[model samples]
Target: MNAPVRRRRRRLPLNVLLGLGLATIVVAVAVLAPVIAPFDPMRMAAGPRLAAPSLAHLFGTDEFGRDLFSRVVRGAHLSLGIGLAAVVAGLAVGGLIGLVAAFAGRLVEAVLLRVIDLLYSFPDTLIALALVAFLGPGLVNATIAIAVSLVPFYARVAYSLAVAERAKPYVEAARLAGIGSGRLVRVHVMPNIGQSLIVMATLGFSSAILSAAGLSFLGLGVQPPSPEWGAILASGRNYITKAPWILIFPGLAICMTVLAFNLLGDSLRDLADPRRTAPQRAGA
Candidate 1:
């Protein structure tokens, strides 16, 4: 008589679930801004200037009398879009550079690593600020600056992970079997390193959003009249004492966006940890 084998299913952690839920809500808000927002985000006198939260204007009105809720909803597109675009750009370019350095000859690897190290020496924010200053202000340039600043981080992560995978017994076995370099990477290295890259990208997204917002706050990001979270915050700076709602709401939006992504990234890292998964595999 043979006993049946029960496949084990991993349950998501509570924090992960919460994080996913929050992130999903944020994405939905960004996607549905046109339909969900009660009034035009840019319309002047949507209500009384600097009105506080109420049923009529959920997040209240700005100093310019625009609906705070609508502006926040609309701003989500720009903020999230910049973060997403930067993360993708950084991940694609940096990940490719790292993969090449890992698999290429030692001379190539050394040169690439030195360049990465040089870039890594500066703080990411400083790099972004310098690039933005040089490129001039606006959404597109700000995104490019943030993406450039993020490259070293993803490059380092990808390089290390790929190197580790390359040294693995399975990868060595594949190489000895006369697999081509491209095929080897496609079959062995990439699958293993991919999850880590995704986790890093998730974490990096929060940083991108914060950077973009900071640049906008400094008047080096999305220009005026374009409903952006940081720009909204900037607009309210002078009205902090008189129209606290303006500052408070946008600040809260930024905080929520950052927090949601951070939580999601942390949860993903925990889920992907080998130590955490090992016990489940052993039990199964």
Candidate 2:
């Protein structure tokens, strides 16, 4: 086999392929919700309240007679959007702080690292809850809270990787060549650490989604009538015994989405650190 083809085949593990497929399906559903959903997710009808799964309502009907399938489909938009947005925010802000702290003088590094440690000392959900409480309950506030809570995590990871990369011979050569500090870090450091950053972002995405959902479930995130999965699950909890399907579908959505992201992250981590596969490859 050609080298390029072999490289391509090795690039994606089975778990990553499955994860990508599952994630894609969810994204497609979320994107096409308006066209694919049979009923207005928020609309209520009198006849089918608490109905079981049927041709008319695949996932069944909620206590309010809203179509469960439509609600789940629509909720995907909020859940996935929050995950992606929060991860992007963390990557931008945390990544910069990390790079600066890694390359700057000892005083600056100490201060930044201490601040990150303070943030990390608290539980992720607790930090998010406090921020939401201060900012007031809403989707925007919840997203901000989640993003902020995740900053320390990304910052620490970036700082460690950047510090390690800075000691390499190429980095020393770049500095000796009189390359600007900013340019050196941007050009040399970032590209080398990009793979690890991507893997972290993928893993962080799952955490972000879970945090967002937890906030929503507590009534501190996306508010009622939003069709957010957490909010939907919270609403269904009151009728757990009477209407189980209402909770089941939304819960399943959360599980499947988180699982897919986790699988992708693990696969990416393995691919980024080739040493994990070195033994098997050597044997072959």
lDDT tens digits, residues 1-284, model 1? 22321111133477688788888988999999999999988899989988988999998898878999999999998899999999999999999999999998799999999999999888888899999999999989999999999888888888888888888899788878999778988877898889988987888888899998889999999998889999999999998888888888889888888888888887787778723321010000
Q: Give the TM-score of candidate 2.
A: 0.91
Candidate 2 per-residue C-alpha lDDT over 191-242 given as tens digits, one digit per residue, 9 for 90 to 100: 9988888888888888888998889999999998889999999999999999
The local distance difference test score of each candidate is: 0.85, 0.85
Candidate 1 least-lDDT 10 residues: 275-284
The RMSD of every model to the true structure, in order and in angstroms, is 6.3, 5.6
Question: Model 1: runs farther than 4 Å from truth?
Answer: 1-12, 274-284
Tell me the spans in candidate 2 whose CA falls farther than 4 Å from its real position.
Answer: 1-12, 274-284
